[model samples]
Target: MSHSGILTLLTDFGLSDPYVGVMKGIIAQVNRSLTVIDLTHHIPPQNIHLARFALMTAIPYFPARTVHVAVVDPGVGSDRRPVAVALGSDPNAPMGFLVGPDNGLFSGVLSQYPALEAVELTESQYWWTATPSSTFHGRDIFAPVGAHLASGVPLQKLGTTIAVDSLVMLHSLTPQRTKHTLTGCIQAVDHFGNLVTNIPASEVNGQTWYAVVKDVTVLGRKTYSDSAPGELLAFVGSHSWVEIAVNQGNAQSVLNLGIGDAVQVILNQPHSSQGD
Candidate 1:
């Protein structure tokens, strides 16, 4: 494994604490020349679901071989395994490394990229220290392993090879489609209080659609602006997921919708008979 020169860190550890900084320092100590990027540190504390979504969305834009370190572990100091896994398979597919605990945090990325190889981080030499703290493996284990991976350490050298199937996984809600409706659930509420659904934008491509949930319905539009203040607007976010927002209000506060809340998308245009 040659050094990729780029590494990204994603964690629920907020900037208010020194945890994020310490992890970065560990990585920097391993490879001084590597460019380190922060994916996000404000992940809402133990909110691994959003962390998964964030990484899955951000991974596509990174260059191949860029090592990604995600430390959203709520199971620290437990029996949970610290692991690093390589993802993607196609020769032209965008593939990279995911170093973190074997929690559901990396499952969203796995849904997008096939797991090529995986290993349990049992080797102490590749870790930050041989006597790692029971807590804060993000600083003790994951950070350094990711740094070593970016510093040209082979995946196999860092830990014992393990079956990808043995790794824990996360299952996101799958959107369902009928001739005139799309059934999905709210996946997350973003910083701006946008209600993000699992429905893909392509589900409404070339058709008119409206989103309904919790007795509130909103028109589908290209943007959530230009509407009257406090009016709801449903649109496709930059991440390509259907999102509901208010013109000048907080959708989460206004709509009172949250993760796992059911969202029904009603198609207004004529239904195509070709696929029916």
Candidate 2:
């Protein structure tokens, strides 16, 4: 199917179980012709920060009016309201719908499109079942509501309007910087064992800097291949974040670093040029 009538899913429910399939089934049941895209079912099991980051990276590629349903809800069935947000007040901004729990899973996407309109998904009739299972609202609540939105249900009719300001925000854990040092924590370790940090690519600037990992000092390079095999290399990763990797090797294994481990960039001197 083409991207029209699109509904995207992002969740921590791995494909090893039937959870992802069940949600797709519910969405299909609502509108079989609607194109349902799985952004990912592997979001580190309620790691909302990672889910938020993934959304920001992926949403830009979808067509306007695509409905994105992300469910990394750790507070599922709690007071955290299910929500369907229509992104952007500006007619020129890419129009779309974001459906999920109001627990900040969409915070990264929301941050980029600041004029979005949101609503609490309180209307039971819009859900797949009136009596939703407490733990699996992804199937009962989010899937159906997102399907309906893709099926042409009015966003306002989904529930009461909410102030965009009222939506929960994930803690913005930005990197700290001083005159010579920039400090950040590893936010994720990817499948290849590259350490993704909170440090922006703008911080590194392709300049001469010391990457302080444990007791080792490696210079920041513009690409992974700039370092020799098995050497620790710091580079601006594909996600535009500073990442630590071992060329042709795994940094997570070699450096013994995981998420939340500190990675520092100590500048030797200011650079003559900046990097994108």
Note each model's CA RMSD in angstroms.
Answer: 4.2, 4.2
Best by lDDT: 1
Instruction: Report the lDDT tens digits of candidate 2 across residue range 29-102.
Output: 88899988888888888788778888887988989889999999999978998998888676444388899998
Best of the candidates, TM-score: 1
Against the hidden true structure, what lDDT does model 1 obtain?
0.86
The clash tally of candidate 2 reads 0
Estimated TM-score for each candidate:
0.93, 0.88
| Clashing residue pairs for model 1 | none
RMSD of 1: 4.2
Off by over 4 Å in 2: 1-3, 91-94, 268-276
lDDT of each: 0.86, 0.83
